[model samples]
Target chain A: MSERIRDFLRRRDDDGPCVVVDLDIVRDNYETFAKALPDTSVYYAVKANPAPEILSLLESLGSSFDCASVGEIEMVLATGASADRISYGNTIKKERDIAKAHAYGVRLFAVDCPEEVEKIARAAPGSRVFCRVLCDGAGAEWPLSRKFGCDPAMAPDVLEHAHRLGLQAYGVSFHVGSQQANLQAWDFALAMAAGVFQEMAVRGIDLKMVNMGGGFPTRYLKDVPGVPSYGAAIFGSLTKHFGNRLPATIIEPGRGMVGNAGLIEAEVVLISKKSEQDEVRWVYLDIGKFHGLAETMDEAIRYPIRTEKDGAETVPCVLAGPTCDSVDVLYEKTPYPLPVSLSIGDKVLIEATGAYTTTYSSVGFNGFAPLASYVI
Target chain B: MSERIRDFLRRRDDDGPCVVVDLDIVRDNYETFAKALPDTSVYYAVKANPAPEILSLLESLGSSFDCASVGEIEMVLATGASADRISYGNTIKKERDIAKAHAYGVRLFAVDCPEEVEKIARAAPGSRVFCRVLCDGAGAEWPLSRKFGCDPAMAPDVLEHAHRLGLQAYGVSFHVGSQQANLQAWDFALAMAAGVFQEMAVRGIDLKMVNMGGGFPTRYLKDVPGVPSYGAAIFGSLTKHFGNRLPATIIEPGRGMVGNAGLIEAEVVLISKKSEQDEVRWVYLDIGKFHGLAETMDEAIRYPIRTEKDGAETVPCVLAGPTCDSVDVLYEKTPYPLPVSLSIGDKVLIEATGAYTTTYSSVGFNGFAPLASYVI
Candidate 1:
């Protein structure tokens, strides 16, 4: 445990459910990656946690932003970051937002379809744009690239459309997936990007940038390779796949940059056996899926939990959030191990919650207040 | 179609995603239930959609409120609702919130556990407290009561605890579930409630109220019977189980009260064949689960969709949201039939969306804005 968490918990006995973000840990996570990947430029994905404190720290450390919407652009710009550092990374965008983002001085945008590429050409003339190719994203905790990418065969056509529309078809991008633990997925994706590059080259369009989109793993309940492991694998893949000529590398890391820095301090509201005959215990916490831990929907991300009651006999229990909604249960499909003696008012530290916690909170589900956070 | 919706669509060309709530339809739905259940008091569950406009309308119609937290209580109070008309319906509540709600003059509270009952008894002494017995909530589209109810065997102890703590021990509550379709489910749930009532009676605790928690169905993708049908089934079940000596009845309606009164106008962002060889077509929309259609998770409570190309040849397409997150895909497990010609910029109407749309929107998922609603 860090000194910041210890200090926070000393005062968090009755403060209710809140996220504690340690500045030191966040700084360490950021600097460690920067040290490992000297050849690649890091653009922090803003959708993970847009808290001004996190953005400000990354900004002070000379980090750029990978934005999905105008709100992300504004959030980063408000933190004293340059607008030129922002890339509108969501392929699907409103025409007005495209014009607005361009007006705000954003130069790079992501496009997957011809209509979107044309919209970008019309809304933000001559802006540098990247085409994202479909990634199978196997061996990932969350296969997020499924919703944003187009077919590999269509990449040459997409870049051709971009060139015809008077936009800079500057790059090809693909996400292995969120929390990509397997290093082999990158080798496959990079080799696939090489195919798209060759196809585009045949079409007389030489893409200048190879955008290795965010999928960087964060240590949660499962152990994952450190920043150096990913950096080494990615660099090796780039060299082997591109063969002495690689495009300008752009690596966007969301969870990897911020996931380990924050912890959620949630109070155990009630520890009840659902029924007398039922053996499984249900532990309800003050904070639930709606409040912020929405990523636990299908147990895709198992957040590590710590309690003050250590060395006590532990039992497998279903974790639930404090809400009237049944879907608020965090882990019923996959039962979580918790101390059998866990009771009301006992605090549980949900670790590595810095990335997706606050951003995914429903505005006010069941009238419960949204998750609150503090950067120490 | 109502004139309000027609007028909105006629003028909504190229407009972004928005919810259009029609007051005329809301009033009609309210009056339909009011005419059917003259014996039952209506307490609108504010968690469904806590729009101030909806609250003000319900307030004007002399409808009471079922609140989950102090925030809901304040929202109702801000709408000029008397504290007497509000019930803190959530079984789980923080100590400070219980005290705050009591300070704001709320006197009715729901409890499923002994600790919560005691907390309320201390926070709001002599308050009208209702014990929620465990309900399987079978046969409902959304099985909601599972999270808030105690086992029937434990109901007596909970009510006894409430009585011992100086609470009024006013009622027993159970939900058939949200979007309950079968009337027979009510028969079984009420029979289960009668068991708890009998146990409490044996303990010399006579409950004064019976809360038939929100389960009334709304007209969505599947047609549901009108309010009269539900009222008839409930009345028949009450007479059969409770005999001539019945407690005062309170029906908390969330989806049933507001589901059909609002519709969402969303623009289709992309319609693409998933791949050259793949058979599935993916339709991307501006509005998605994070922006209000969260009930679509697990294919429960599907809202009916409409487009101007009503007569066009339709094909099954995988629906998705505009965000880059893979989970943002609206309907992939269960594909929806959409017009084959539906292209970019075309609008799709998500019908019967008044209940869980705006309140469930993530604050800002993927930098995309939270849902916007307009009263027509």
Candidate 2:
């Protein structure tokens, strides 16, 4: 760890626990994401980390935001992002939420069901809308079919309903699912979405936007290959399908933009032996599942723990959280190279935890406060 | 869902997604936990939902807090719980945490290492402490023997170190792991603690307290007979072992007190047929893995879903969460007997989610606001 990181950990207030975000890395990540798709508007998924500074940084990078709730809209609006740039992406929403979106002048929203269509139409009669279609790619990491999207079979009818309500249903949206290994999944989904739009046009509805919803892949560990560049492939496919008539494209990338930019700094509390099972050591850290790192329960990615000196000395340690609950383990059998001793008070960094880290906390446990970020 | 619960959900500003906590059931749970351990002063574990309201309720119920951080001490202090009543139960802590605890008049704390003893001696000078002993019966649920406790073999040396510091070394504390299925595990732990205390007495260190650190079981599901009576077998064994001369027993029950008192009320988002698995269907709800229900992960606990009318007819549904992540499943093959006419707007009460439900959250995604709770 740099003296800077150690300085921050040492400065933790006696009153609360915190997740220290690196705004400088976040900005660099935003720039990298923007440089990849210069023509496409990247709607930073506000769900990643809604810290005001994070939103401000994304806005500074000229990124739009994909909001799911009225509070998200308010958060983005508070950052002074234009309402035209925000998309209320929840396909299924309550009446009050729809009303709040319209009241706040959020023009673009996704509609997955006719009930949501009716709700949006009644609440925001003239809003720009996107019809979310469910496309199941067999090889995607997580398939979004049949859950949050309109079935392809129902797409034409959805467009018809949107037109009947006099709403400018101008876009088609599909989520390729997060951490997806197959970049071709986006190609297949966009092709299917194009067919849906053509089908909609045959039924007399003209579309003006195509939102390839946020599922951009991100890689944390160095050994794993960096996520494939879907921007080039997606743009290539979209151009081939629409033939220069392609609508303004929007991409909502949450984890991709921020997942790898943050690091969680914690300290080893104690080391213990469990049994004859190779001296299972427990390193109780100050952080817990409440920090964004534990959400990787879905993925097999383990952030390699690097000590203050950045040496790879390996030792097998079970990283447990400060919470008394036994399930508060960050890693169960994580191997840390051990030539150097890991005693109490040694600071360790768990990498790539920026996105959902601080924003996901209830901030009510004890007086434990959420982490704050400063631009390095 | 009750009208009151509906009121909590409805009052949400539709800006962000949130977990709603019912403070009413929390107050009732404090009373229930206190009533069960009438003779023993209950030290409510601050780790479980350490909201100020929770601390206030525990204080109002005449229960103390088992704090793990200086921040937790301040949280309990803010609730008007005397600092003397709070025990810094995290056996291993930072030197700064020790300093803050001493500065704030927190005398009772737990120590697990000789180095920690040296640090605390330098930081706090004369702290009344308890040495945590590693009891062997740590069950599969959550084993503390891995991280925070010292081996019983080393207890004699730890007591000697504390004695040399001239600190008032009160007693020994042992956790029999959280969620232990073996009720016999508690008795075994009590016997082990008793032996350790007797050993300490032989070493000329008079012990005044033996905290069989709280792992009292609570019910997670209906017909799950694993959850035993909190008052009978476990506490009864403590009395049987130490008789009238037993030290002031401190039990830090975190989840047991609040686990069953609350339920998560959510709306069914999508009910979809699985294309590959012929008989498998997915019923998605608005809650996600970020909610406290994720505790059911890897555990046999089934957070049974029920309708407003308790004995409604049942149907089998695979309940999933709203997150785009595929792992955001709430229950696998949950047999929910649903009404034949069940629709999208139908409500569900996720049972036994009260304890850490609202306190543990990933509020980071899109203005997801915490849910509001109504006390009945």
Candidate 3:
């Protein structure tokens, strides 16, 4: 366990689980990304962690924001960040919310379809828009599917329609996926985005921006390469494809920016053998899937667990969240290696939990309070 | 489509999707259960749909409650429901919360462990306690796991320990599992509970209650038998097992009591083919797993879907929630047969969603608001 986590747990007064964020680590992660990609502007995705303090700190660092909804736009504005720094990244939105975001001074919007572009034209009127090119999120831990983005072949026509609607179809964008593992995924998505750019160029429409959507990986159980490696690979791919013709760049980093800075100090509520003959044990924690760790649904993303009972013989155990619902079992499908000596009241530190932890929590699930966060 | 739903769709004022609950149906569902099981006391499980209006209506109907947390207890109290009528049913609870609930006038609690019984013994001394017996939860639509139960073999000793701890070991409880479809599942559970009761009697500890925990099935896509059938099967099993003498019985009904009363009016945000040549279509809705209908996870409990173009040629489509998250795809793993004529602006009615709908919603996930419920 990290010294920061141990100290946080030792000095904790709360009875149950809470996320403790170290702003220093967050600043370091931001600087690492900033130092790596000089030409690219970082638009922190607020959906990952919308804590006001985290936003305030990142706003002070001159970081831009990628908002998904009017509520998120309001949150960013509440952080005293410039409205010009906000980009409505979500393509699926209500017309009223689009107008609201525009009224709130958001000028940049992401669109993938003609209907959405029309809505933007009517609501936001003449705002700069980026059309997302469709690509199956390959080589990512959490692969986003056909919910957003349209065909790259269709993106040119979509952009042309946006231009016809009097909106500035300024760019092309695509997401490799969230927590993209293989660096080649970036090249694949960028290639797709480039195809759209080329097709638009052929149609006498020159796109000015290339929004590289968020997929930057964060370290959890796997040995994720540093942000510099990603920067090198991305920049190399951009140079190979575009040479000196790179467009005004935008990079949205959700998980990669804030994922590594937070740790959850969860107390073990109970430990018992599920069945008398079963080999595995069941370790129940005060926090579970509903309490903000719902990303563990398929064990697609594994959070490394650290126990106070270190150096002891480890055994495979099914970890559960504190809820009456059967589906709240956190690690039954993917059992965790927990110390056999781990008992009730022992603190378990869930590492790299900052990104999708607090924001994803269900409001009062099973009457349990939403996750509490402490930014240090 | 039902007339109530058609009228609701025609009159929706909100720009986003919402859950419209028919209060008449809710009261009828309660009456149905009450009339079917005249001997059994009804305790509505508040965690399923803890809407204050629902609580108030149920309170007016003279219904008791099964609360899992202090928050739920407070909500129930706010509805003018007496605390003595509320049973703290969650086995996993902190000692302080237990004391708080007791101070709020809750005398009944369900526990599955000796540690919990001891905690209750100190916090709510001389209160009624029920020990849940472990079962595999076989033959149910949503089979519950071993999250809140103890081994049947250990129940006698556990109850004896509870008695020794100065707590009243008044009942033995077991869940057939939520949305239980099989009549035999209840018999198996009741038989197990009887064994525990017999053992307790031999130890000179008289047990006077048996909580046939909530599993009562509700109407979804398939035909579910009515409450009368369940009552007949249960009464038959109770007579066959314990002929002359019977305990004061309690049935905690969550889904069965309120599931069929609610219908979610969600707008079809977008419907598009996943790929150019891909045969399957993706239908995106305003609400998804993160929004309110999380039970769609694993498709364990399928909600019957109704579209405006019901008579049109049907095509199979993957239903998804309106979020950037990839896992928000509700029916991709199990696609639904939707109308080919269904358009983007059409509304889909999700039936039997009153229970486990609004309460489990993620607060502002992806910046979308919570599932709004209108009680008619």
Candidate 4:
């Protein structure tokens, strides 16, 4: 945990679970991305954590924003950032929402299908549009499905449709996946994007930029490669494909930008076994899937957990949230190894929680309040 | 859809997706349950919807409440219901929360382990506690894991511990599962409860109540057994297990009580194919998993969807929510069939969504507002 978070927790007098984000880490992370990719622009994905404090910090640091909806666009504008700095990044959107974003002066949008392109064409007029091509999302812990992007072969046609409807066919974009460990995953997607660029070129419609979508990893239980490694691999891939006629590039980093900057401190509510013969102990915490920690669905994102007795003997325990719903169990198929001395009311710190914890929290599932967030 | 909800939709000028609940349907559902199980008391599960209107109506109808947390208990009490009618039904809880519930005049609680019993013994001393035993949740569409309850063999000891700590060993409780269709599922659980009751009798302690936790199904894509069938089957099981020495029974129905009373009207955002050669179309809706349709996780709860062009030719389509997250896809493994004439901006009414929809909505995930609710 960051020293700022430790100090904040030591002085905290509030009850219930809460997440503490150290702005220093977020500031440092932004600089690392900026230094790693000197040419590529960084559009911080607002859906990761839309806390106004984080947005203001990133805005002051000259960072752009990638918003999923019009509500997020307004938030970015509230940070005093220009509309040009925002990219409406979600592929699926209502026509009215597109019109609203256009009214707010957001000129850049991400689109996959021709139907979406038609909506944007009427709503945003000459707004710049990027066609997101499909990636298999291999080698990522939380791999994305085919919900956002279309086939790589269809990108040219989609952009051409946008051009036909009086919208600027900006470029091609693709996401490898979330929490991606393989640096080589981007190579294939970049090649596909290059193919789209060539296809667009053949049609006499030049795509100016390549929007490389976010797949950047964050350190959890296992260490991930630094941002510099990702930057070098992506730059190498761009050179290999484009050969000296490199297009302008943009990278949307959501998890990588903020995941390691936050920590959640939760108290253990209860700990027990089903029976005397049962070997695994079930540890219930004050927070759960509905409150926060929704990323633990399917145990896909195993967070690194620490307790006061971290140096003590460890035992594999079934971790769960304090809810009546049965699906609230965090780690059960593969039990989480918590300190054997972990007791009821003892505080446990969950690291690497800054990205997707706050917003995913239900409004009042089981009457629990939303995950409290504090930006230090 | 009920006439009341249809009328509400006709008059609704709101732009975003909203759920309209017919209080008439809820009243009818309560009457059905009351008639079917004449001997049992209905403890409406507050986690199902927790709308003040629903709670006040149920309170006026003489229904007790099964609350999962202190906040839920407070919501129930706000309806002017007596605190004696509320049961803190969650098996896992913090000591402070237990004390809070006790201060709010709640005298009954659920416990699955000795540690929890100890907490209640100290915090809410002399309060009645029920032991929840684990049910395998077989034949349940949304099957619960072994997160809430303990083994049947361990229950007698748990209750004895509560008894030893100056707390009343109330009775046994078990959930067959959510969306449970198998009528015989309750047979095994009731038998286990009977075994625990006999053990308590052997120790000269009389357990008074058998809290049959909710598992009753709502009509979705397929027809499920009605309340009368479930009531009759449960009564038979109780007779077989208890042998004319029946304990006072309580049925906690969340989905079964409120599921059929609500309908969600969501607008189609976009409809398209991933590729020119792709056969299946993709249908995007204004609302999704993070909004209100969270029960559609794994496509387990397929609510019957109706479009204006329902009678026209149908085609298999993957349904998704309007979010940047790829996991927001609703129906993909088994693509849902929609009308070929269903176009963007067409209204689709999702039926049987009243129970779990409103509460599961995220607090502005992807910058979308929480699901709006209207009870008439």
Candidate with best TM-score? 4
Whole-model lDDT values for every prediction: 0.85, 0.69, 0.85, 0.94
Two-way DockQ contest, 3 vs 4, winner: 4
Compose the digit string of candidate 3's lDDT tens values, residues B1-376.
3467668768777677788777788899899888888999999999988888888999999899999889899999999888888999988777788899999999999888777788889889999999988887788877787777888887887789899988899989889888888999989888888888899999999999999988998888889888999999998888877777888888989888778888898888767653366678888888899889899887777888888799899988988888878778788777899999998778788888888888788877877787888777
Listed in order, the DockQ scores are 0.61, 0.34, 0.53, 0.91
CAPRI category for model 4: high
| Superposition TM-score, candidate 4 onto the true structure | 0.99
**Location of the lowest summed lDDT over 10 successive residues in candidate 4 chain B:** B140-149
Candidate 3: which pairs clash? none
Q: Encode model 4's per-residue lDDT on A148-170: one tens digit a residue.
A: 88988888999999999999999
Give per-residue CA lDDT, model 3, range A328-364, as digits (tens). Answer: 8888776899998897668898999998888788888
lDDT of 4: 0.94
Q: How close is candidate 1 to the true structure, as a TM-score?
A: 0.96
Q: TM-score of every model? A: 0.96, 0.84, 0.94, 0.99
Instruction: State interface RMSD in Å for all models.
Output: 2.0, 4.2, 2.1, 0.8
RMSD (Å) per prediction:
2.1, 4.6, 2.5, 0.9
Residue A86 deviation, candidate 1, in Å?
2.1
Arranged by TM-score, best first: 4, 1, 3, 2
Candidate 3 local accuracy as lDDT? 0.85
**Global Cα lDDT for candidate 1:** 0.85
What TM-score does each prediction get for chain A alone? 0.97, 0.89, 0.97, 0.99
